[model samples]
Target: MTTKENNYTSLEVGTFESLLSRNYKGIEGKFFIGNELGLSGCEVSLNRLPAGKAVPFVHAHKKNEELYIITGGNGTFFVDGVEFNVQEGSLVRVAPAGARAYKAGDKDLYFICIQAQAGSLTQATHEDGIILNTKASWMNGKK
Candidate 1:
Protein backbone atom coordinates (compact mmCIF):
# COMPACT_ATOMS: atom_id res chain seq x y z
CA MET A 1 0.00 0.00 0.00
CA THR A 2 0.96 3.64 -0.54
CA THR A 3 -0.25 7.00 0.65
CA LYS A 4 0.24 10.65 -0.23
CA GLU A 5 -0.88 13.10 2.39
CA ASN A 6 -1.03 16.83 1.82
CA ASN A 7 2.58 17.47 2.68
CA TYR A 8 4.07 14.01 2.87
CA THR A 9 4.09 10.70 1.06
CA SER A 10 4.44 7.31 2.68
CA LEU A 11 4.89 3.87 1.24
CA GLU A 12 6.45 0.52 2.00
CA VAL A 13 8.23 -1.20 -0.85
CA GLY A 14 9.21 -4.20 1.23
CA THR A 15 11.10 -5.32 4.26
CA PHE A 16 14.88 -5.42 4.42
CA GLU A 17 14.94 -9.22 4.35
CA SER A 18 12.90 -9.22 1.13
CA LEU A 19 14.87 -6.52 -0.61
CA LEU A 20 16.57 -8.90 -2.98
CA SER A 21 13.75 -11.41 -3.20
CA ARG A 22 11.75 -9.63 -5.89
CA ASN A 23 12.60 -9.15 -9.56
CA TYR A 24 13.11 -5.72 -11.02
CA LYS A 25 13.62 -5.08 -14.74
CA GLY A 26 14.44 -8.74 -15.47
CA ILE A 27 17.01 -8.74 -12.66
CA GLU A 28 16.58 -9.65 -9.06
CA GLY A 29 17.16 -7.13 -6.25
CA LYS A 30 16.94 -3.61 -7.57
CA PHE A 31 14.40 -0.88 -6.94
CA PHE A 32 14.00 2.85 -7.42
CA ILE A 33 11.66 4.81 -5.16
CA GLY A 34 12.06 8.50 -5.87
CA ASN A 35 9.55 8.64 -8.67
CA GLU A 36 7.04 6.49 -6.86
CA LEU A 37 7.21 8.71 -3.81
CA GLY A 38 6.88 11.93 -5.86
CA LEU A 39 10.25 13.15 -4.83
CA SER A 40 11.61 16.30 -6.41
CA GLY A 41 15.00 16.64 -4.78
CA CYS A 42 16.66 13.30 -5.43
CA GLU A 43 16.58 9.93 -7.02
CA VAL A 44 17.10 6.98 -4.71
CA SER A 45 17.76 3.39 -5.63
CA LEU A 46 18.30 0.19 -3.68
CA ASN A 47 20.50 -2.43 -5.24
CA ARG A 48 21.93 -5.83 -4.46
CA LEU A 49 24.84 -7.19 -6.39
CA PRO A 50 25.75 -10.84 -6.21
CA ALA A 51 29.18 -12.18 -5.43
CA GLY A 52 31.94 -11.12 -7.83
CA LYS A 53 29.53 -9.12 -9.94
CA ALA A 54 30.21 -5.65 -11.25
CA VAL A 55 28.47 -2.79 -13.02
CA PRO A 56 30.14 -3.74 -16.35
CA PHE A 57 30.67 -0.10 -17.31
CA VAL A 58 32.35 2.96 -15.90
CA HIS A 59 30.35 6.17 -16.07
CA ALA A 60 30.15 9.68 -14.73
CA HIS A 61 27.26 11.96 -14.06
CA LYS A 62 26.85 15.10 -16.09
CA LYS A 63 25.47 17.25 -13.28
CA ASN A 64 24.39 15.09 -10.37
CA GLU A 65 26.58 13.79 -7.59
CA GLU A 66 26.00 10.37 -6.16
CA LEU A 67 26.08 9.17 -2.59
CA TYR A 68 26.40 5.46 -1.97
CA ILE A 69 25.57 3.97 1.39
CA ILE A 70 26.79 0.43 1.80
CA THR A 71 24.22 -1.37 3.84
CA GLY A 72 25.49 -4.96 3.84
CA GLY A 73 28.36 -7.14 2.63
CA ASN A 74 31.51 -5.92 0.91
CA GLY A 75 32.45 -4.40 -2.41
CA THR A 76 35.14 -2.72 -4.48
CA PHE A 77 34.67 0.82 -5.74
CA PHE A 78 36.62 2.35 -8.57
CA VAL A 79 36.62 6.06 -9.26
CA ASP A 80 38.67 7.84 -11.86
CA GLY A 81 41.87 5.80 -11.46
CA VAL A 82 41.53 4.97 -7.80
CA GLU A 83 40.22 1.71 -6.43
CA PHE A 84 39.18 1.08 -2.85
CA ASN A 85 37.53 -1.45 -0.58
CA VAL A 86 34.04 -0.72 0.72
CA GLN A 87 32.10 -2.74 3.25
CA GLU A 88 29.11 -2.43 5.49
CA GLY A 89 28.77 1.01 7.10
CA SER A 90 30.82 2.58 4.32
CA LEU A 91 29.55 5.80 2.82
CA VAL A 92 30.93 7.12 -0.46
CA ARG A 93 30.34 10.33 -2.33
CA VAL A 94 31.20 10.80 -5.99
CA ALA A 95 31.17 14.14 -7.66
CA PRO A 96 29.40 14.84 -10.93
CA ALA A 97 32.39 14.09 -13.11
CA GLY A 98 33.98 11.27 -11.17
CA ALA A 99 33.89 8.19 -13.33
CA ARG A 100 32.93 5.32 -11.09
CA ALA A 101 32.13 1.64 -10.96
CA TYR A 102 31.56 -1.09 -8.38
CA LYS A 103 32.04 -4.82 -7.93
CA ALA A 104 30.62 -7.03 -5.26
CA GLY A 105 33.03 -8.95 -3.09
CA ASP A 106 32.73 -12.62 -2.13
CA LYS A 107 29.22 -12.07 -0.81
CA ASP A 108 26.11 -10.23 -1.89
CA LEU A 109 26.56 -6.50 -1.69
CA TYR A 110 23.66 -4.26 -0.79
CA PHE A 111 23.63 -0.49 -1.15
CA ILE A 112 21.50 2.57 -1.64
CA CYS A 113 22.38 5.32 -4.04
CA ILE A 114 21.08 8.85 -3.67
CA GLN A 115 21.56 11.18 -6.60
CA ALA A 116 21.07 14.92 -6.53
CA GLN A 117 22.34 17.86 -8.46
CA ALA A 118 25.70 19.13 -7.33
CA GLY A 119 25.66 22.39 -5.38
CA SER A 120 21.89 22.31 -5.25
CA LEU A 121 21.59 22.43 -1.50
CA THR A 122 21.53 26.10 -0.64
CA GLN A 123 20.05 25.43 2.82
CA ALA A 124 20.57 22.67 5.31
CA THR A 125 18.55 21.38 8.26
CA HIS A 126 19.27 24.36 10.52
CA GLU A 127 18.55 26.87 7.80
CA ASP A 128 15.56 25.32 6.04
CA GLY A 129 13.57 23.72 8.81
CA ILE A 130 10.73 25.09 10.92
CA ILE A 131 9.53 24.16 14.41
CA LEU A 132 5.77 24.04 14.50
CA ASN A 133 3.92 25.02 17.64
CA THR A 134 2.09 21.77 18.00
CA LYS A 135 2.38 18.33 19.54
CA ALA A 136 2.22 14.88 18.04
CA SER A 137 -1.05 12.99 17.82
CA TRP A 138 0.10 10.60 20.51
CA MET A 139 1.76 13.35 22.55
CA ASN A 140 -1.31 15.56 22.81
CA GLY A 141 -0.81 16.13 26.52
CA LYS A 142 2.29 14.24 27.50
CA LYS A 143 5.44 16.00 28.57
Candidate 2:
Protein backbone atom coordinates (compact mmCIF):
# COMPACT_ATOMS: atom_id res chain seq x y z
CA MET A 1 0.00 0.00 0.00
CA THR A 2 1.10 3.54 -0.75
CA THR A 3 -0.04 6.71 0.97
CA LYS A 4 0.42 10.33 0.01
CA GLU A 5 -0.71 12.61 2.80
CA ASN A 6 -0.19 16.28 3.47
CA ASN A 7 2.59 15.75 5.99
CA TYR A 8 4.38 12.83 4.41
CA THR A 9 4.73 10.46 1.47
CA SER A 10 4.75 6.67 1.59
CA LEU A 11 5.87 4.42 -1.21
CA GLU A 12 5.49 0.69 -1.49
CA VAL A 13 8.55 -0.38 -3.37
CA GLY A 14 7.64 -4.04 -3.10
CA THR A 15 10.01 -6.86 -2.18
CA PHE A 16 13.75 -7.16 -2.78
CA GLU A 17 13.08 -9.42 -5.74
CA SER A 18 10.96 -6.73 -7.37
CA LEU A 19 13.70 -4.20 -6.87
CA LEU A 20 16.28 -6.42 -8.53
CA SER A 21 14.15 -7.11 -11.57
CA ARG A 22 14.15 -3.55 -12.78
CA ASN A 23 16.45 -2.64 -15.65
CA TYR A 24 16.69 0.92 -16.92
CA LYS A 25 17.83 0.63 -20.52
CA GLY A 26 20.95 -1.49 -20.32
CA ILE A 27 21.65 -0.98 -16.62
CA GLU A 28 20.11 -3.47 -14.25
CA GLY A 29 19.30 -3.42 -10.52
CA LYS A 30 19.41 0.23 -9.53
CA PHE A 31 16.66 2.59 -8.45
CA PHE A 32 16.72 6.17 -7.28
CA ILE A 33 13.66 6.93 -5.18
CA GLY A 34 14.48 10.24 -3.57
CA ASN A 35 12.64 12.31 -6.16
CA GLU A 36 9.66 9.97 -6.02
CA LEU A 37 9.32 10.94 -2.36
CA GLY A 38 10.07 14.62 -2.94
CA LEU A 39 13.17 14.48 -0.82
CA SER A 40 14.87 17.78 -0.03
CA GLY A 41 17.73 17.00 2.29
CA CYS A 42 19.16 13.80 0.94
CA GLU A 43 19.22 11.35 -1.94
CA VAL A 44 18.50 7.64 -1.48
CA SER A 45 19.07 4.82 -3.90
CA LEU A 46 18.30 1.12 -3.68
CA ASN A 47 20.85 -0.89 -5.56
CA ARG A 48 21.39 -4.57 -6.29
CA LEU A 49 24.43 -5.11 -8.43
CA PRO A 50 24.90 -8.44 -10.18
CA ALA A 51 27.82 -10.63 -9.20
CA GLY A 52 31.18 -9.36 -10.41
CA LYS A 53 29.83 -6.03 -11.58
CA ALA A 54 31.08 -2.69 -10.26
CA VAL A 55 30.00 0.87 -10.42
CA PRO A 56 31.38 2.29 -13.63
CA PHE A 57 33.56 4.89 -11.96
CA VAL A 58 34.76 6.39 -8.73
CA HIS A 59 33.14 9.47 -7.31
CA ALA A 60 33.45 11.95 -4.45
CA HIS A 61 31.04 14.41 -2.94
CA LYS A 62 31.76 18.08 -2.73
CA LYS A 63 29.64 18.59 0.38
CA ASN A 64 27.73 15.41 1.03
CA GLU A 65 28.97 12.27 2.69
CA GLU A 66 27.50 8.90 1.74
CA LEU A 67 26.39 6.19 4.13
CA TYR A 68 26.03 2.78 2.57
CA ILE A 69 24.00 0.20 4.45
CA ILE A 70 24.74 -3.22 3.11
CA THR A 71 21.64 -5.33 3.30
CA GLY A 72 22.81 -8.50 1.50
CA GLY A 73 25.56 -10.39 -0.29
CA ASN A 74 29.20 -9.23 -0.51
CA GLY A 75 31.36 -6.52 -2.01
CA THR A 76 34.62 -4.65 -1.76
CA PHE A 77 34.43 -0.91 -1.24
CA PHE A 78 37.29 1.26 -2.32
CA VAL A 79 37.98 4.54 -0.64
CA ASP A 80 40.93 6.74 -1.37
CA GLY A 81 42.87 3.89 -2.95
CA VAL A 82 42.16 1.66 0.09
CA GLU A 83 39.94 -1.39 0.02
CA PHE A 84 37.41 -2.55 2.59
CA ASN A 85 35.61 -5.88 2.37
CA VAL A 86 31.90 -5.41 3.01
CA GLN A 87 28.97 -7.77 3.36
CA GLU A 88 25.43 -8.11 4.67
CA GLY A 89 26.05 -6.36 7.97
CA SER A 90 28.54 -3.75 6.80
CA LEU A 91 27.88 -0.06 7.23
CA VAL A 92 30.22 2.35 5.50
CA ARG A 93 30.63 6.10 5.74
CA VAL A 94 32.57 7.94 3.09
CA ALA A 95 33.59 11.47 3.89
CA PRO A 96 32.83 14.29 1.47
CA ALA A 97 36.13 14.09 -0.37
CA GLY A 98 36.83 10.39 -0.16
CA ALA A 99 36.96 8.85 -3.60
CA ARG A 100 34.89 5.72 -3.63
CA ALA A 101 33.91 2.75 -5.77
CA TYR A 102 32.42 -0.70 -5.22
CA LYS A 103 32.52 -4.16 -6.81
CA ALA A 104 30.06 -6.95 -6.15
CA GLY A 105 31.28 -10.35 -5.01
CA ASP A 106 30.34 -13.92 -6.00
CA LYS A 107 26.69 -13.28 -5.26
CA ASP A 108 24.49 -10.33 -5.96
CA LEU A 109 25.01 -7.35 -3.64
CA TYR A 110 22.20 -5.28 -2.22
CA PHE A 111 22.62 -1.96 -0.49
CA ILE A 112 20.92 1.29 0.28
CA CYS A 113 22.89 4.46 -0.15
CA ILE A 114 21.93 7.66 1.61
CA GLN A 115 23.70 10.93 0.88
CA ALA A 116 23.35 14.17 2.79
CA GLN A 117 25.40 17.20 3.60
CA ALA A 118 28.38 16.30 5.74
CA GLY A 119 28.32 17.81 9.24
CA SER A 120 25.06 19.60 8.47
CA LEU A 121 22.82 17.91 11.01
CA THR A 122 22.18 20.21 13.94
CA GLN A 123 19.90 17.86 15.82
CA ALA A 124 19.02 14.20 15.87
CA THR A 125 15.53 12.72 16.40
CA HIS A 126 15.87 12.71 20.18
CA GLU A 127 16.77 16.36 20.27
CA ASP A 128 14.33 17.56 17.62
CA GLY A 129 11.23 15.54 18.37
CA ILE A 130 8.28 17.17 20.10
CA ILE A 131 6.16 15.20 22.51
CA LEU A 132 2.62 15.69 21.31
CA ASN A 133 -0.31 15.47 23.68
CA THR A 134 -2.41 13.92 20.92
CA LYS A 135 -2.67 10.18 20.67
CA ALA A 136 -2.05 8.26 17.49
CA SER A 137 -5.23 6.83 16.00
CA TRP A 138 -3.25 3.88 14.67
CA MET A 139 -2.58 2.82 18.25
CA ASN A 140 -6.11 1.43 18.24
CA GLY A 141 -4.69 -1.57 16.29
CA LYS A 142 -5.90 -0.69 12.84
CA LYS A 143 -2.94 -0.21 10.62
Candidate 3:
Protein backbone atom coordinates (compact mmCIF):
# COMPACT_ATOMS: atom_id res chain seq x y z
CA MET A 1 0.00 0.00 0.00
CA THR A 2 1.11 3.56 -0.72
CA THR A 3 0.76 6.46 1.70
CA LYS A 4 0.50 10.21 1.14
CA GLU A 5 3.10 12.28 2.98
CA ASN A 6 1.47 15.68 3.35
CA ASN A 7 -1.93 17.32 2.95
CA TYR A 8 -0.96 20.98 2.98
CA THR A 9 -0.04 23.58 0.39
CA SER A 10 1.51 27.03 0.64
CA LEU A 11 0.26 30.24 -0.93
CA GLU A 12 2.01 33.58 -1.30
CA VAL A 13 1.71 35.52 1.98
CA GLY A 14 1.42 39.07 0.71
CA THR A 15 -1.85 40.77 -0.30
CA PHE A 16 -0.68 43.84 -2.25
CA GLU A 17 0.54 41.82 -5.22
CA SER A 18 -2.53 39.57 -5.22
CA LEU A 19 -5.25 42.21 -5.30
CA LEU A 20 -7.31 42.26 -8.50
CA SER A 21 -9.68 45.04 -9.44
CA ARG A 22 -13.32 44.17 -9.96
CA ASN A 23 -16.31 46.33 -10.87
CA TYR A 24 -19.98 45.82 -11.45
CA LYS A 25 -22.27 48.69 -12.36
CA GLY A 26 -21.35 51.48 -9.89
CA ILE A 27 -19.36 49.36 -7.41
CA GLU A 28 -15.62 49.04 -7.78
CA GLY A 29 -12.64 47.81 -5.77
CA LYS A 30 -10.23 44.89 -5.44
CA PHE A 31 -10.12 41.33 -4.10
CA PHE A 32 -7.10 39.43 -2.82
CA ILE A 33 -7.98 35.73 -2.41
CA GLY A 34 -10.08 33.28 -4.41
CA ASN A 35 -10.52 29.63 -5.43
CA GLU A 36 -7.12 29.72 -7.09
CA LEU A 37 -5.80 28.30 -3.86
CA GLY A 38 -7.68 24.99 -4.28
CA LEU A 39 -9.45 25.21 -0.92
CA SER A 40 -12.08 22.61 -0.16
CA GLY A 41 -15.56 22.92 1.33
CA CYS A 42 -15.27 26.69 1.66
CA GLU A 43 -14.69 29.86 -0.32
CA VAL A 44 -12.59 32.71 1.06
CA SER A 45 -11.97 36.21 -0.27
CA LEU A 46 -10.29 39.36 0.97
CA ASN A 47 -12.13 42.38 -0.41
CA ARG A 48 -11.28 46.07 -0.46
CA LEU A 49 -13.75 48.85 -1.09
CA PRO A 50 -12.80 52.40 -1.80
CA ALA A 51 -14.19 55.19 0.34
CA GLY A 52 -17.86 56.03 -0.44
CA LYS A 53 -18.40 52.92 -2.56
CA ALA A 54 -20.62 50.01 -1.67
CA VAL A 55 -21.16 46.52 -2.89
CA PRO A 56 -23.33 46.54 -5.97
CA PHE A 57 -26.25 44.69 -4.45
CA VAL A 58 -27.66 42.93 -1.46
CA HIS A 59 -27.44 39.18 -1.83
CA ALA A 60 -28.20 35.98 0.01
CA HIS A 61 -27.24 32.35 -0.42
CA LYS A 62 -29.59 29.38 -0.53
CA LYS A 63 -27.40 26.90 1.29
CA ASN A 64 -24.28 28.65 2.41
CA GLU A 65 -23.69 30.92 5.40
CA GLU A 66 -21.06 33.63 5.38
CA LEU A 67 -18.78 35.20 7.96
CA TYR A 68 -17.18 38.58 7.39
CA ILE A 69 -14.14 39.67 9.34
CA ILE A 70 -13.53 43.39 9.11
CA THR A 71 -9.82 44.06 9.13
CA GLY A 72 -9.46 47.75 8.25
CA GLY A 73 -11.36 51.02 7.92
CA ASN A 74 -15.00 51.55 8.77
CA GLY A 75 -18.23 50.60 7.06
CA THR A 76 -21.97 50.30 7.45
CA PHE A 77 -23.23 46.79 6.96
CA PHE A 78 -26.86 46.41 6.05
CA VAL A 79 -28.54 43.16 6.88
CA ASP A 80 -32.21 43.02 6.02
CA GLY A 81 -32.55 46.79 6.17
CA VAL A 82 -30.85 47.22 9.55
CA GLU A 83 -27.53 49.05 9.66
CA PHE A 84 -24.57 47.96 11.74
CA ASN A 85 -21.27 49.76 12.12
CA VAL A 86 -18.23 47.67 11.39
CA GLN A 87 -14.55 48.42 11.80
CA GLU A 88 -11.25 46.70 12.29
CA GLY A 89 -11.65 43.56 14.46
CA SER A 90 -15.37 43.28 13.87
CA LEU A 91 -16.78 39.92 12.92
CA VAL A 92 -20.20 39.42 11.44
CA ARG A 93 -22.10 36.31 10.49
CA VAL A 94 -24.98 36.10 8.05
CA ALA A 95 -27.24 33.15 7.64
CA PRO A 96 -28.03 31.68 4.26
CA ALA A 97 -31.28 33.57 3.91
CA GLY A 98 -30.25 36.95 5.27
CA ALA A 99 -29.78 39.67 2.69
CA ARG A 100 -26.65 41.74 3.21
CA ALA A 101 -24.45 44.50 1.77
CA TYR A 102 -22.01 47.17 2.89
CA LYS A 103 -20.73 50.69 2.16
CA ALA A 104 -17.29 51.98 2.93
CA GLY A 105 -16.58 55.10 4.98
CA ASP A 106 -13.85 57.72 4.47
CA LYS A 107 -11.06 55.16 4.58
CA ASP A 108 -10.67 52.11 2.36
CA LEU A 109 -12.59 49.10 3.69
CA TYR A 110 -10.87 45.74 3.94
CA PHE A 111 -12.60 42.53 4.99
CA ILE A 112 -12.30 38.81 4.63
CA CYS A 113 -15.40 36.85 3.71
CA ILE A 114 -15.64 33.15 4.25
CA GLN A 115 -18.58 31.05 3.13
CA ALA A 116 -19.44 27.43 3.63
CA GLN A 117 -22.50 25.23 3.72
CA ALA A 118 -23.61 24.55 7.28
CA GLY A 119 -22.33 21.27 8.70
CA SER A 120 -20.42 20.40 5.50
CA LEU A 121 -17.04 20.70 7.13
CA THR A 122 -17.68 17.82 9.49
CA GLN A 123 -18.27 15.24 6.78
CA ALA A 124 -15.86 12.40 6.29
CA THR A 125 -13.00 12.63 3.83
CA HIS A 126 -12.07 10.33 0.95
CA GLU A 127 -12.26 7.28 3.15
CA ASP A 128 -16.03 7.76 3.22
CA GLY A 129 -16.28 7.72 -0.62
CA ILE A 130 -15.33 11.32 -1.30
CA ILE A 131 -13.20 11.92 -4.36
CA LEU A 132 -10.71 14.65 -5.11
CA ASN A 133 -10.13 15.56 -8.74
CA THR A 134 -7.10 16.99 -10.46
CA LYS A 135 -6.77 20.78 -10.42
CA ALA A 136 -8.65 22.28 -13.33
CA SER A 137 -7.83 25.33 -15.44
CA TRP A 138 -11.32 26.79 -15.51
CA MET A 139 -10.59 29.54 -12.99
CA ASN A 140 -7.34 30.47 -14.76
CA GLY A 141 -9.08 31.52 -18.02
CA LYS A 142 -7.95 28.44 -19.85
CA LYS A 143 -10.17 26.43 -22.16
Top candidate when judged by TM-score against the true structure: 1
**Per-residue lDDT of 40-99 in model 1, one digit per residue for the tens?**
999998888887888877999999999999999999999998999999999999999999
TM per candidate comes to: 0.88, 0.87, 0.71
Candidate 1, residue 8: lDDT: 95
Instruction: Report the C-alpha displacement of residue 141, candidate 1, in angstroms.
Output: 6.6
TM-score of model number 3 = 0.71
RMSD of each: 2.1, 2.5, 10.9
Candidate 3 runs further than 4 Å off: 1-6, 16-27, 30-34, 121-143
Give the alpha-carbon lDDT of every model: 0.89, 0.89, 0.76
Off by over 4 Å in 1: 21-27, 138-143
Clashing pairs in 3: none
Model 2 steric clash pairs: none
Ranking of candidates on TM-score, top first: 1, 2, 3
**Model 3 Cα lDDT, one tens digit per residue, 1-143:** 22223785556545632343554343454443444566777888777787788877899999989999988888899999999899999999999999999998987788888998976765565656855575667856676
- Tell me the tens digit of each residue's lDDT in model 2 across 1-143: 66889999999988665776776555688888888898989999888988899988899989999999999999999999999899999999999999999999998899999999999899999999999778788776687
